[model samples]
Target: MSTVVDYTTFAVGCLLALAGLISLLAGWAPTWLRHVERPRLFGAWALCLGTFCVTQLPALRTEVIKLGDPAIDACVVLLLISAAALLLGLRRPRRQ
Candidate 1:
């Protein structure tokens, strides 16, 4: 069950990251997402968050663990900061 959860998380995270990348570079996004005031910024946040989620998988965690606790903590902090920056940079959507 845990393995299943891990794979699901990884898969979801990958899809999210891919979508974010596409949105950020190509400006292709679903209609619902177009309503956002700053789609590109949101995309950047999604990419960072997805990356963080991917790193949370047990397999990746094990690799990071081999590097030491500080390494893992630093990576988490960096990703969080990056995601937060992108999110905070976004403004409220204009009134339609």
Candidate 2:
């Protein structure tokens, strides 16, 4: 299989990777997120889905081309959910 991910997939992959890194860092080091009880779990999900997107981008494209929607849908929906988790977690106040 070709190593090249097409432009759209590459763009999504890059975004996912950035989101994952930010989520993981925020969950681990940022003082504000420390108060969020489960930031790390969101981080894990984001990182995992992001890594999956990046690594499997080629196959993902293939799945799309083949009209196998579930694989592609899962990647996008799961990542969005995880990203939302990180965002919501960031909005919480630290424990007193």
For every model shown, what is its TM-score relative to the native structure?
Answer: 0.73, 0.43
The residue-by-residue lDDT of candidate 1 on 1-96, one tens digit each, is 999989888888888788778878975556766445566766776677777778879989788899998978867885886567566655656698
- Residue 51 in candidate 2, Cα distance off native in Å: 3.6
For each candidate, C-alpha RMSD in Å? 2.9, 6.4
Off by over 4 Å in 1: 82-86, 89-96
Against the true structure, candidate 1 reaches a TM-score of 0.73
lDDT score of residue 1 within candidate 2: 32
Give per-residue lDDT, candidate 2, residue 22. 80
Q: Residue-wise lDDT of candidate 2 within 26-95, one digit each (tens)?
A: 7553455444556565566556566556646665557665776776676677667766766665546649
lDDT of each: 0.74, 0.62
Deviation (Å) of 92 in candidate 2: 3.3
The candidate that wins on TM-score is 1
